[model samples]
Target: MPEHASGASSKLIVESVSKWFRTPRATVHALDSISMQVAAGEVVCLVGPSGCGKSTLLDIIAGLTKPDSGHVLADGHLVTGPGRQRLVVFQEPSLFPWLDVFGNVMFGLKLCPELTNDGRREIAHRFLGLVGLEKFERVHVHELSGGMKQRVALARALAADPQVLLMDEPFGALDAMTREHLYDDVQRIWRDAGKTIVFVTHNMREAVCLGDRVLLMSQAPGKIIQAFDIPLPRPRSIYDVELVGYAARIADALRGTVGGGVPE
Candidate 1:
């Protein structure tokens, strides 16, 4: 663990968390005594080889999955289950086919029942615009391109006004060009929204580009092996020379942990 792993100013805390999976064949240990903290409005990226429990950790923090041991806290409160304050944007858009883009975003606001219908609708449109999809509000999910669908998913997640945003490789399925464009969009949105983000990715460069801190995980049962503070200037480019240097260093560390080649 590093100095930044946990601190008094932390917004999200994972204390000695662990998890396991039991099946007919065998019981697999997926996580081991994981503990870390995410500061408010900070962006942290988790990177590791496949099957390293990266997604599992994200789910635990999101309260989508319960830890077998220990616990997680958000804003000094225990995370018993999913709450409106924590939202996830998964790899796939997972939008409803029956709903248009605006309808999809509006649906996420269902979590915020305190708001009136008109207020929720306004928020949906505002988030759609933030993600540069206001014009496509009426477009059906099936008609949108892969990147467009992901943008809609982001808008939906943001519309809920979650205090913490958990993203599990939201851009993994897009083409290279689309991903590059999205890298910029995500940075802008994150800055403007000032939301705490826990992003999980297999791409080292992507992590370096977006993270204020990059936490490397070991193979299952996953543990936070190293934390690299990226003090680089904001609105980073994936292809920047300095950014590439950081990515390469993290990639070397990743390979050492996995005992093989690093994921893209």
Candidate 2:
């Protein structure tokens, strides 16, 4: 568990952030004057069309990639490089093939080297249980299903005790039925663990179901064009009538961005 839970400041500030990708033919502006603040322990989802720099922005926030201008601040300190404080959970599980479930999770705790082996084991077990995978701790990665592989990944990230969790379409590849199950699990884990989360996805309903606020990014020169606050109760159903309405609005907004047309 994190040292601070509720009321602990895990705020993230993106100040005038911008990025560009240079190619032989052209220099593409990936992000433009992006700025936003994510409150401590709040779940914020980034939703946009295919070309929008959603993943690029996430990499910047994680310090995995450097921005051409501006900076990201976690709890008032600038983020220069990847650190344990801000961990990224990618679309792929990226687990070691030879490592079993328990070993894969323990690998995340390598960020906390000061802890004894037993301490790390305890943290690993606790988080695996949190993700409802305690019984399969010793199972090999190949033996697990796609959903279960992601569960281990989630546990590994949580066990690292990162103040901010950055997820890039973590469930985008899953089947619809599996994704619904994860929606419930993720919300429960976020509520109980109390960590600031920035989730990036193309799925509007996924954003509506999981995020407290959904940020819509425009195409190519990605900019935050709209932000919708989801005031619905937690453990939101993807099938909820009201939630469907919210998703529709966001989807329309995304379409407008993609087509370069005015929003309906």
lDDT, candidate 2, 104-191, per-residue tens: 9999899999999999999999999999999999999999999999999999999999999999999989999999999999999998
Sequence-dependent TM-score of model 2: 0.94
Clashes of 1: 0
lDDT, model 2, position 195: 89
In order of appearance, the predictions have TM-scores of: 0.97, 0.94
Weakest 10 consecutive residues of candidate 1 by summed lDDT: 1-10
Query: Against the hidden true structure, what lDDT does model 2 obtain?
Result: 0.90
Q: Residues 1-264, candidate 1: write the lDDT tens digits.
A: 362655677889999999999999999999999989999888999998899899999999999999999999999999999998999999999999999999999988888989999999889989999999999999999999999999999999999999999999999998989999899988999889999999999999999999999999999999989999999998899989999999999999988866778854
* Cα lDDT, model 1, residue 137: 94
The whole-model lDDT of each prediction reads: 0.92, 0.90
Clashing pairs in 2: none
The candidate that achieves the highest lDDT relative to the unseen native structure? 1
State the TM-score for model 1.
Answer: 0.97
